[model samples]
Target chain A: MAGAIAGALAVFFVLSVYLLPQSYLGSIHPTRPGPIVTDVKLSQTQVVLGESFSLQVSATNSGEHADMQILSIAFPSLSSTDGIVDVQKHDFRQTPLFIKKDRAIGAGYTAQRLVPAQYPSIEASNRPWNSGETFSIELSIKPQTEGEFVIFVKAVGLPHNGDQAHWPSNGTIDHQDEFVSVYSVNVTKA
Target chain B: MNYQRGSLARMQESRRLVIGYTLVSAGILLAASGGTWDVTNHLLNKPETFFAPPHAVLYTGVASALAGMALVVSASRAAGQFDWSAKFLIAGVALLLSAGPVDFVWHSTFGLDGLLSPPHSVLVSGMVTSSIAAIIGLVRASKVLPAALIVVAILPVWISAAGAVHMFSLPFSNTAYFNFNPHPIAGAIVATLGFPLITAAISHTSSELTGRKFGILSATAAIFLFINTFTSIIPNEALVSTIPFYIATVIPFVVADAILARWRSPKSLYMAGAIVGITFFMLYYPLITHTYNKVMDNKTVWGSLTAIIYFELMGPLYPVLLAPAAAMGILGAMIGQGMVRRAILAGLR
Candidate 1:
């Protein structure tokens, strides 16, 4: 009886550790309301090595909430699956759409990281992305090595709560962009 | 105690120490390596999933450490030596492991600091408390070598602490868009606070080891961390190659041995700590600044010139950073001595 009780307690503690937070914090932010969409577009898809380009980012609120506040706009993460191709295919998570990856590469690079740097960070926030707003930023890119690259972009911010992490605007956040325009830059032998 | 009884007691002590050491060592090894791996994956844009492989590795380490501490407590209880340090370790491991899922929730609810954020601090503190408690047990038993092994196993936690404090630092300090750099003053302060305590504890446990042994410990720890960190960076080979950090880390400890050879006594430990802190910066500066300045050209957003410019801006901090390091070192030594005394009294010996 004692042994059985011990085993049960062990299981309970482990489960409690893993599940408690989800339920508790989930109550607060509750994975935004429904599917929100982020969109990305490239000025031109094909470019030569060492050439410069621009990427345009926009967001649309599909959920019921009308006043969601977006905090930061960031580049994709540092994973193979986080490159432009994977992001468009919905292979990577939406949360990292605000990547912690360095702004070494201005425009973007491939999933393989053949280039040295990742995409640069979004320039300092001009303003929080609001509902039904189509805001964009222009970034410059110079590729040292030649390869086809996919750039990842994302925006992260609080909701109607304004600075409150999970103010629950009753609208779900779309971690992935609803539509992404992926362009391949081929760096030629200079 | 009769001779036979003494022999039996010694055997039991040996048995307890071995079991505890094995478990904790295995735990720390996994936890540290898994931590580095997880960060690397995080760096690579691997989403922070609860069941990710690196997370598993880290949890395994935590579980193993927990199990080890449990066994140690059990053994101590059986022997009528209810070691409080062992008990604290057990409790701390439980708390540390619990923080994992909580961390995920924190991210989902708020966002990730990607550093030693609040929830993450709970995890780091749990490990530190448990580790120090376990180390106390080892030191109490007077097992110098096994104790050293434990320190080496968990050395990365210290490095992580350094990185976490850096993450909390000013944005200008992170201009390279890297987590760490040539001059990590905040990290140095954290290191000063932690390493001195560890050194003082080792001295108490080993008795004759305050001088050469201290430096040797640093050298060994640097090598282990170096290898582990280098291994973690290997998978990102296509992204960017890293310089050998262990070289810079180990140099100071080796040099500090001679600098503080004549120092002893508890108060002098403060000076000894100050020496260690200063030595680390003195050796670390040229090694990282000059090399990284040349290596990080236009390939980086900061560019070589900008990176060097920032490096120069922080250059005057050589004395500034080292001063606090020395103060923290002294404070660590003083606290370590107090803790060591408590550990001994708590029946750890």
Candidate 2:
């Protein structure tokens, strides 16, 4: 009887492990309400003063069942700092660029210069980003000072299913924005 | 004691008991191998699916262990003989079985977990408990079991106990849902104190049970080194530089075994235990470096680069740790001797 009970448990365990949904057992950071940044990579974290570095990042629609659009990827800190760094080049073509100045942002962020590094291509920018598809952004930056600096990267987009008129703004360099990632760059005097 | 020589012999020779013990031993060894492989796979950034081969092997061993425990319990009851080892085996099996479901729920809720999460702790704790059961079981039946089997039993006890210590000290237990990571100083204290204690305790038990046998401790230590080297060190190209250093660690184990065999006094036991205990840091090698990393503020990404990080940390860390670790090992040996004496008084042998 003890053997039989153990055998039954073994069968149950095997079934649970094999048949469970991938959403339940496989991955973390499940589908959210907006497009979320998935991965961020820097060409170099430490660069000589006045030298250039690049930031490569990707975002995906994290809506559980709804498709979202890739509106823009912004660096909200570069423009605010006095002379620490400057955005040199970006890969976004025929997209609008704007400076959001003196705007009180999300939680714990004092109002500073908010700069949109790149907006999505206009034709498909408003269309659904689609599930499993990613929006990649690359920016070349030059450090103007010889100290460590944090660049706050955020994605802005909205689920197509939502009826809100303007793009639902999710980009904020603050603690409340879970979709934001902070990248550090250390500049050395050479 | 109620057990006569004839009765003890009959118990050892019982066919069901023999089969039960063999199955349990094989099952645990299989699980230990799978656990090691699983950690390696995780390090390699392989897919974290239940269908992964390592998990299959580990769970298969768990099933086999469950079946073996059931058989052993039934046979012991039928013979009207129930000992502490059998009880420990049953409790260990229960904990092992329960850990599966608990771990599943934890993963489902928290997504990915680290080394020291609640469920993983329970699982390693189960492994330690069952290993102790096997060691005591084989030690008591030493007259009938071969020396090879006893050595095999000791291997799991050592690996599993090391795993249990790593669970608290590896500095990787925090997850999205919960922060299970212990403080760095706390982890350092645990590893510094825990590793030697485990090593010396196991050495003392093996020495006393084998009648201060000359080769048993060395044999078990050799097998452990070979297995860890094959699974952990040999696989990563970066760890190649540390191979000779890892191999050199077995000298103390050999020396300890020789000392215990030739000189059977308490003083020699303490000396042997300290020698065996000092080897704990080297015995665990690259993985043990994580605890040291925590205290020294060395950040690691824990992939191929981990080898370079461990090598750098070892130079500064080993000198500070050796003496305290040896002191703890002596204490462990005393505790282990006390355990053997208690078991003898209870007629386990």
What lDDT score is found at residue B272 in candidate 2? 74
lDDT tens readout by residue for model 2, A1-190: 3354345434433332232212223322222335556777888889998788887666665553222244334444345433433344433322323333443332211112233323211112323344455666666667676787566665544322232212234443343232445568898998
lDDT of 2 at B43: 59
TM-score of chain A of 2: 0.50
TM-score of 1: 0.52
Per-candidate RMSD, Å: 19.6, 17.6
The true-versus-predicted C-alpha distance at residue B45 of model 2, in Å, is: 2.2
Estimate the TM-score of every prediction: 0.52, 0.64
Chain A of model 1, TM-score against the native? 0.40
Q: Write model 1 residue lDDT over B212-281, tens digit each, in one string.
A: 3445445544654454545444534321222332233444343333333444555555654554444333
List where candidate 2 sits over 4 angstroms from the true fold. A1-190, B1-13
